[model samples]
Target: MAGEMAAGLAEEGGSKIKMIVSYVDNLPNGSEEGLFYALDLGGTNFRVLRVQLAGKEKRVVKRESREVSIPPHLMSSNSSELFGFIASALTKFVADEGHNALFNDRQRELGFTFSFPVRQTSITSGTLIKWTKAFSIDDAVGEDVVAELQTAMEKQGLDMRVSALINDTVGTLAAGSYYDEDVVVGVILGTGSNAAYLEKASAIPKLEGDIPKSGKMIFEKLISGMYLGEIVRRVLLKITLQSSIFGNIDKTKLRTHFILRTPDISAMHHDGTPDLRIVAEKLADNLKITDTSLETRKMVVEICDIVTRRSARLAAAGIVGILRKIGRGNPGDKHKSVVAIDGGLYEHYTEFRQCLESTLTELLGEEASKSVTVKLTNDGSGLGAALIAAAHSQY
Candidate 1:
């Protein structure tokens, strides 16, 4: 994986792992002060945030945020409709906050956290390379995402400038670095999995022209919340077709793609009842498989465990891969390398988080693992975007 990442960084195309440039040369220095906004659009939900910073002394003095779920239709809708819905949500959030949230008369600046593959043109603009995690807006592909949002904002009479455009992993890295300067890698394991890390500008071979002082690279992963449930569903479906463990059960719900969510699996996996009641409950509730035997419930839990463990182990390997790429995985490296992780999978799924952390430690070995730390930054991407906006503010 480490070698693949290097190859991806050097190659312009055809690499399974795309080490895309983030165009974020600078992270927040913790001295940025003022009011800033952040819009995080990733997966089925989007979030808007406003933050008031008081420079180095106080950090974030005030903050407000709102989360809006995108309708299923919007995920497959045209670019205009999706952006319009997002922009309308942002306008409402701004109006609800009123002028009191403003630090001064300066125009509102926003940092956009777009968690998708993008070919960045600059720090403030990037064209969508493609959509992931269920989004498939055909017209939006190859279009400048920042411009799309900007146009939508204009149509809604919202006055704001997008100062920074970044991936969620980049934002999480920025957020982590704000408090701990040692943080170098950021990983997101929620709806979709991806990682971003700061790399020496000179190391990227595909980069053209003069190299900046710093560079960041992002890559995607398949083992994440968005696909975990579907994986479990497929496994169960295969088992049902091959055996009679389910005993003539209606496979209608099981046949449905994405019918079982990560949360449902997490709940079932964490069931501690003597009878594995939660497992049976989830099977009944989500897959409509009721009156499950204790043995069958155990099998279901085992499946969840197997799937979750695989994902966590793979995620651990990914982190180690990044660490190795950056020359920080060796036992001789005494520097404290902190990996900032965010997303619902890492934050809310206790078992997944534990398995990931433990697997990471195991992969690093006891001696080398002592110098590494994985910190959870809940909603760090959103706050980091706001901070980046402040850092790049036109004041």
Candidate 2:
């Protein structure tokens, strides 16, 4: 068996397995201070926060929130439109809370928490390689996200500096580390999902550098909230064709749309059987057309169940992979392998969460599993952003 991952998150004693390591970890050190703001732009909504920092002693003494819905057209709309909307909303937040000393006598600084994947170059700079999770902002791909936000802020006439452009996972790690130095990894299981962990530079085969104690790593966002509905869609189309669900339907119209969100998946999971296809048809019926055929519903539910099942399993695998990469495996290692989990899918999807934890247990056995703790830490993105603002606060 491969080396036990995350103490008990991976299997042990199966057979000897070969492993190769790659990727660099650049997790930031958790010491600094300043009042700061954080803006989270993820699916459906954008959240803005104003946090007052009190440093390590008083830490994140103040916080506020506002949610902005993306107009239906903007989701499938252009990049300029997407970022522009975010810019405008941020402008409004800044203007509404005018003249806060969070700026520390200079322009205000912020930590932008983005959930999408990026090829990060620095804490504050990264190139958006591609947009997934239902985002098709083609123009924004290959551009520096921090710079984009900077440009947008300038356009909005908001005097702000982006000190950090972090993915939600990194923010979670930072948040975790800020509280407990032992927290090495952070995982988000909301509608969509991803993970981040502290890594040693020497452990990374892909990069050449001395391992910085402050450096850590973030994982891929292959399976997260934004992508689950699409996953269900891909699996359901085949079932729909054979099951007569769309026999009376317009394929052309059905061909172009998003039918499910993570909430639907959560609902199906609670339905006992957790059938995906049934959930899909149920979802389609709710959003698209009238329902009749039993076979159609069955086909949809079963397909949905299968896709959801597979996604959970794969997510566990990715976690296994990360824990392995971080040297957290090995039975009875006794290390406190804390995986701080957040997000909608993991939090709301009971069956999915069970399956993931079950898979991890199977992979990592009793003794090692004892050392592994999976915890639900809600909305660290906002609080963590506040924490960063506090840590970097100049006031």
Candidate 3:
């Protein structure tokens, strides 16, 4: 069903035949030398990396990573402050290392994974559409983010270039496509949810003014980790009102934060439709005492299972929607489709992965299921950004 949904989405977009290509598949095969930098800004934290690509033989070519926590104030702060912090972090990263010949002359070139809805002007520039992931920054939408980062970097004497700006989904697609010709879509089922697929430039009606010769369109932030929290919040309001623990309990004081969504999912698993006493015990772990000597093991198992199932089924529905959109799952086509799956959810949760695949199979049919394989593509954001950096470089 997921495949059909994606295909349907493509058909709606006026695609004659849905063909989702991953950009990573297009990576140049050669022994090339280039210094690349990738900055990943997502929920909770941000990471900046400098990668040395030795092309095919050496691959990764070497990498360095640094993590910085996003300040609580920044989520609600003005753009200047937010960009300033990012600029300061990047400046610190550069100053941590001395002159390196490969990227010294062009220390200005870098790739940024903004992980939010931005009206991209090109591969290198975009405007912030709005803040998601519980972020409510005013006057942020329509602001040029790349320019903001650039101006801030200069103020800090940081000699770096934001040559490419991509969404995490696009990065995943790029990274997956680099290794597998069959990988067509990149999905992040982390704190939130989103998907990215390679689309033909000719198919985008929204961008009627200009057409790139490469014929590529990348959709980011439209669906990603930042919004899942909101989705959870919406679902919980309905569930709790109908369930036991919250049916009569006043929830007016419960802060509706993005983090609460995780617990909400856990709550739904424990009590959405009753028979949740055991699971509820787990959810109330802080409220109760779990005797390790007893059935504590069983409670944990049940809690994990139910929550994973709930998350997976909803995720499957989203995938199914996209598949139906693309015309890939319809009995009318025979081409195999591959989804490049990433993120903490699919990575850490075994039951969740199983449930997701099961739901997709139930929606798409056995034949299509055989043709559709959801494969994990790890750390695609970091690697894929580097790939984008390489592609945009003159070398």
How well does each candidate superpose onto the true structure, as a TM-score? 0.86, 0.70, 0.70
lDDT of 3 by residue, 1-395 (tens): 34543343444334322232223224423344677788888666889888777766676647888989989998788888888998899888877655563644555568788877665667766777667676777867878888888899999988778877887777887777666667777888775566777555554434433222211222222223344334444444555566543434445533345533344444434354344454545434432322332243344445445545666787787676666655666554576777888887677655577789999999887767777778898877787787676777654
For each of the candidates, give the backbone clash count: 0, 36, 39
Error of 3 at 144 (Å): 0.5
How far residue 159's Cα lies from its native spot in candidate 2, in Å, is 4.2
- Off-target runs (Cα >4 Å) in candidate 1 are 43-45, 68-106, 129-139, 151-159, 209-222
Off by over 4 Å in 2: 1-33, 43-45, 69-92, 95-107, 115-119, 128-143, 151-159, 208-257, 260-262, 272-304, 386-395
Q: Model 1 over residues 102-161: C-alpha lDDT tens digits?
A: 766788999999877777878888788778789988999889999999999999999999
TM-score of 2: 0.70
Q: What TM-score quantifies how close candidate 1 is to the native fold?
A: 0.86
Note the Cα lDDT for every prediction shown.
0.86, 0.64, 0.64
What lDDT is obtained when candidate 3 is compared to the true structure? 0.64
Highest lDDT, which number? 1
Q: 51-90 in candidate 2: lDDT tens per residue?
A: 6655567765666789988887877777677777888888
RMSD to native for every prediction? 4.3, 7.4, 7.0
Q: Return the lDDT, model 3, position 75.
A: 79
- As a whole number from 0 to 100, the lDDT of residue 114 in candidate 1 is 85
